[model samples]
Target chain A: MITPSPALPIAVPLVAAAFLAGLRKFLRRWLADLIATATAAANLWLCTALLRASWHSNIVYWFGNWFPRGRMVVGIGFEVDPVGAGLATLACLLTLLGFIYSWRITDSGRDLFQPLMLIFMAAMCGFAMTADLFNLFVFFELMSTAAFALCGLKTHEPAPLQGAFNFAVTNTVGAFLILTGIALVYAVTGALNMAQIGFLLGSRHDLLVIAAAAFLCSGFLIKAAIAPFHFWLPDAHSVAPTPVCVLFSGLMVELGAFAVLRMTSVMFGQSLLQPHSAFRATLLLLGSLTVVWGGLMCFAEHHLKRVLAFSTISHGGAMLLGVAIGTPAAITGWLTYLFAHAMAKAGLFFTAGILLHRLQSMSEPQLFKRGRPLRFTAVLWLLGGIALAALPPFGLSNGEDLIESATHAHAIHLWVTLMFFFTSAMTGAAVFRVGMRVFFGLGDAGPADRAAKIDEAPDGPEEQHHIPARMFLPAALCIALSAAPAYIPGFGRWFFNAAHRFLAQSLYIARIYAQPVHYVLPPAPHSDLGSTLMHGAIAVVCALLLASWAVFHLALPRGFRGATHLEGPMFPLRKLQSGHPGDYVVWCMVGFVLLGGCLFLLP
Target chain B: MNQIVHIFPYLVAGWVFLCGLYGIATSRHLVHTVISLAVVQTSTYVLLLNIGFRTGGAAPVFADISPGITTVDPIVQALMLTDVVVEATVMALLLAMVVKAYEKAGTLSPDDLRLMRG
Candidate 1:
């Protein structure tokens, strides 16, 4: 039997997208969606096959058979390790689910959504698998261009235009930043292949390298929605169609963290693997700040999608923390957390889409007491929240366990534990508060926040009586799968093995050069399940208390409640997210300089 | 003079990048913002081309040159070409958004597009 080529996952969707776009006017809606859905499924199958093939070892596929001549790479390569392939697989799965969810939901554009979604999927798959630095930039631009177009899919709305514009500008700037970093690295190493560059620049710490690291990290952190660089995310999420928001929060933002992990491991692993490297410290500090900032703002938001958007930011911060730790166990935790978060977050967005479809609004106050009949959706929403809270028996709990156990010997263990608890609780509180207020009608309607005033047209026909099975199936499957890893029995052992190989830089270089791959696998790190469960339980209880406090604040005594409201103190922080693209650009510049200076001067 | 020539192009690229960002942050019109973004992208072209430049290098045209002839790095030029295409696409899309925002909101000023302010 002929094995499926690695490039098929990217090429199939792109070719289908072009075919669909060219013949859009002649094709009927069902035919277009059928072709897109089939293409997505085919891509998923191919990626899954690639994942299985790469499970034992990395699959290095050089285009046109131009293998690296000795140490020099002549052709672009797709290095498909299980981690990268798994990410590509997840992208395909989400895109397929997105297509299914949007089958009947009509947008204003004529047959444009499917093509854009296809291109977006292809770009993400390419980004996940490509090993060339310039190739990564090309795929990054392709992804951003597709995302900007998708965000502005609803040009009829003024807010979407503004949102898409900010997204385009900031992300375009980010792409340029990445390009600059790539240029700097190329200037020094004279190669665009990541493995070659890493081989050439081994253990050489210098000014240029520091600057490149800064630009690259900041560029991707912007994409990942870290604080100060995260202004575009909520704006984009607040206006983009529901199905698009699922991809945005589910995998795209997490891909930024994935890129950072990939870049550091392949390019700067030797220097950064130092015990007290300032680079890791800087990343850790930023991760903690992002968790706190994103969590607090998440709880303060009134818009449903924006709430989820901030939750994405908080969870992204947690992933960055895992990557920042840079242990095999930490990497495993990051991969697990990423998978669980993608599913649960997509499920939450799907449930929000359902509410928007039925109720014609995304404002928590507007949706208050109106979601009484969506009991199934309510259950999905709360289950997704529990996943976000890292409750036991969920994949998120396992991910958190692995990360904490990996860092137990470190001096910063307490700090990591606290950030995890705070972010999970805060984000969970935000979602739970919304679910209780909307589904159970436990609280009276509060005044709408400023975010509620933003206009958001529902993606589907409003006032729908019944949720379609297509829409509900994907969300249900997502929530179910988010809990699958915990029950899979040997999932941690298997994943830790894959992640150990992923973090093994020598094995990666060896694979690219077609040298005999001889590397002994380290024993997988063990999770302290007891400590993790205790912490997870506390986080869940804290989330419940916080949600209850926010929902029934009016009935509670003022003396007992203290002098602050959950949403009140967040006013100063919220002002930084002003919708002006100019202000956002200014902040992006500040972030670049600050991050560059830190990375340069720290060590 | 040699030192100045060696570093001149890099300095110019950095200056142009900063200027573009400054224009974006201070621009009054949305059209200007899009143009500023293009200007920012132009710096990458300058940087890439400058990196590939040699003192007496020829254009990277293999059809006419001998096998061992000195030529600029073809890869950076190729990268610059891709960058230009990406810039044009982004600019076109941003310009379209500017037009739509103007049509829907009746204004082009970022200050007036306050519909999404937190």
Candidate 2:
């Protein structure tokens, strides 16, 4: 009988973050690790207890014990449903594991790292549990800001700084759009609580509502790094520290997809489920494009981390495609894929980190030349790669089977399913290529590669310098978790059922209020008319004209040299080295104007 | 008359918000961005207050005096107060980060700070 308290997880980390900020000078490096590990551990415990209790009952906490007076609810509230509770628990556990993974890295300022990590945890928990829109925005800001700081932890490195800067700008734009959407929705509904608003606008459709939904979805999509908005993801994930990379690629992007699920379910549930159509086509199109784009990009990349990053984007698209299908089986597939991918990706990152630590390089060619002696790391990485590629015996394979069987009847569904499978195969091939290079290629340690050798005295056992026991333990746990769904009967049902219920509840509400929602309508009715025609033309032209031109230009040797030269100068652009306040102001202004105009004019 | 009064504050808040956004968009300095964000935040606060306002609403604060006029929407006011606190914290933190950046980079021009790329 654990009483669900809303403030414990959020409050604990927030206070610890502030305290660590002040104690930076006295406690030094150990302080960050100690505080971060403790707070994450506490959060994990609290969420686990909440999960257990929530299995049998629901917990609702009201701010100041304020009850609704005449339908105008004044008090802020947090409700811990089974789904939210489960997600929160898993999020906390993974964050704790991530912190443990980073325990040995002393190069970065420990003081700042601990506080940022705590804030990140707090923000994530707050995002998962908050029932109010404005509060959601606040939590969103906290998480993004913390992420920005953490991404730039190693400021001396150009790659990390650039990656963090790009991530910051794009995500800030996304956040602004979310805020604008919130404001618009507030104007229309006059209620902050999600359930209350859903109830109030249950039977209405309007331009305002559609605009709001679009704005909100765009923000989350960018955060999730779904195709066109995905440019910032690879660099950020590849450049950040290994543990941070794992968290960013594994958990943070998923949060965006989760947000889209939550918002669509809560606000526009009915519209999404209309028998004839809704936003499904748009989602499917984006999802399929992201799948192909990510797979192809992975094939082109030489950097191990960047390849993993592209793989994440590809898998994210597949998950979104499942959700877009909006069927019971599809939702099941989505949840299953979410959990499985998190484990697999985190394990891969961990292994990658160990390799980088041992070899002092992330380049595939260099890594291949100086072969890693650690067989355990290779084995784990192979297992992780297999799971990521959705091979048989992996949980993702089962999830994909369910999704394919369920959606095989419809043409669009079938196409999407095929695309997803194709991408998975491509991803597997890419991983195999890299793996072959590293494990089987000729071992030619170049002249400069002398630095890669670890100094050990003659007749002394080779110093381990491998992954710490704590880190390896978690990686193994994750790998085991990835394999569990195939062996354990109905193990995934708990999460799947929760996701289904969430989707069903929203659909139920949307069905009830589909007619009165006159103000917030979508951009036109269906994707079958002018937009489809335009898309067809564009695709044809791109294939016929642009494709050949690109190939021809890329084929010439001078073209390759010229391209590399051009790319060399642009390398420094990645650092966000611009110290000019004027440019930042202009960028911010332009973003604001564009966002503001869209909000005001769209209706 | 009642409707007019009710809508007047919303209009004012909207105008103020637009102006603040404009300032934020045009301003070149880091401090200016913070100030602009504050202004945008203030617009929301005003809107919250306006939503809660009654024609002759009394102050929401509790005191020794007996309840006289209708108490304003205490809920909105409380939420607004919390928002102000959040905004203040965000502004202060941004300022601190800006100062740190200035110390390290020797300039605040975002255009000039090009240390990273693809």
Number of the top lDDT candidate: 1
What is candidate 2's lDDT per residue for A413-439, written digit by digit as tens?
668657666556656655655565576
Q: Write the per-residue lDDT of candidate 1 for residues A1-603, one digit (tens) a residue.
A: 354888898889999999999999999889999999999999998998988888788999999999998889999998999888898999999999999998957565657999999999999999999989889988998999999999999998898999999999999999989999999999999999999988998998888888788888889888988877889999999988887898999999999988988898998888555767888888898888889999988988889999999999998988889998978998899888999999999999999988888888999889999998889999999999999999877788888878877788779888998889998899999999999899999967655788877777876655789788998999999999998887788788778877998888888888999889977777877776787688888998999998888888788887755313566534778888888888998898887887777777777
Error of 1 at B24 (Å): 1.4
Off by over 4 Å in 2: A1-4, A28-35, A69-71, A442-466, A506-603, B1-116
> Could you tell me the TM-score of chain A in candidate 1?
0.98
Measured by DockQ, the strongest candidate is: 1
Q: For residues B1-118, write the lDDT of model 1, one tens digit per residue.
A: 9999888988999999999999899988899999998889889888898889876889989998899878889999888888888888989999999999999988898888877788
For residue B65, give model 2's deviation from the true position in Å.
11
Each prediction's DockQ against the real complex: 0.85, 0.25
